[model samples]
Target: MSNKNPSTTRIVELAKQKSFNTEKKVLDTIKSMIKNKKVINYNTVAKESTVSKSFLYKNTSIRKKIDMIRNEQADLKNVTNHKGNTSDKSKDVIIESLKFKIERLEKEKQELKDALAAKYNDFYNNL
Candidate 1:
């Protein structure tokens, strides 16, 4: 016979079953939301399922499924080219951002060089 009391074992089993049922319920809620094209975020899932938001975030598998769906949905909104690549607008945006960054960096570099030249002139005069 096991060391644990029968009642305690029964209680533990019931708790485990409850947890499993709740997980299933949450998953079903997510599926229904997907079928209905509803948002699949933590708050929406929890609200639709009547479960706790913490519970939705706390469960690893459920969290991953939600994240995967949400990310896939977000990607659907992007403008893609024929080969499922970035659109011209997206490329243009990326190019503009890089150009801005390069210009800013070049300005900073010039400022540094000017400061260094002034410092060198002072050092030479002092020597």
Candidate 2:
């Protein structure tokens, strides 16, 4: 029969509690990071949360959540890119056209000012 000391049993229980606490803390940190829109990949989570990558992979719920978030981000990027291409081109064209119109109007305003100044000089000379 194996000998089991009371002190040794208590020590083992304490160690298990510590391990569970550490895992819970790390999981909470990971959730907070996700809520804050920080990176959610294995390496980033492991680095930011001080949790091992192996531990994250071994935990099925955490691994699934990370994968789902990553996939959603990827899908959002693709959709944005597809929609933005056409809109961006049109926006660029409109902006350039507006800039050209403003430049032309400014030039016309300067010409009118110069003409008015010349006419005033002529009127003063004739007076």
Candidate 3:
């Protein structure tokens, strides 16, 4: 009941092939980005791979993989932050100790100068 010509059939076939190729290319790009430890968020991947954000969200497998990577990165960041806090605390303690030492040294230096001045005055008077 339809006049489907050979050229139209061939065009449809080529279009389908092109779409398949594009999808495959996008998936391949995503895998490569993951392997390279690149940021695997939806926006980043979509931008880098030239894939539509809607396609990424609609594909359940890709969406899940991206989510997994995102979660792993978040966990790593949290651990690093916790360790940094401990290091900061130690650094604070070291800074405080250095400040106390500087204050003690300044006080000692003032006392020595006063003693030296008194000794010089005594020598001048005895002369």
Per-residue CA lDDT of model 1 for 55-122, tens digit only, reads 88888999999999989887875644235588999988889999999999999999999999999999
Q: Per-residue lDDT of 33-113 in model 2, one digit per residue for the tens?
A: 878978678898888878789988887877887799889878877886644356877988888999999999999999999
Query: lDDT at 54 for candidate 3?
Result: 94
Ordered from best to worst lDDT, the candidate numbers read 1, 3, 2
Candidate 1 residue pairs in backbone clash: none
Candidate 2 Cα errors over 4 Å, as ranges = 1-8, 82-127
The lDDT of model 3 is 0.84
Q: Which tens-of-lDDT digit does each residue in 1-127 have in candidate 3?
A: 8757535778899988976786777778878997888877889988988988998888787788888988998888788764434677798898899999999999999999999999999999999
Q: Model 3, poorest ten-residue lDDT window?
A: 80-89
Residue 96 accuracy (lDDT) in model 3: 99
TM-score order, best first, reads 1, 3, 2
**CA-lDDT, candidates in order:** 0.89, 0.83, 0.84
Q: Compute the lDDT of residue 125 as modeled in candidate 3.
A: 98
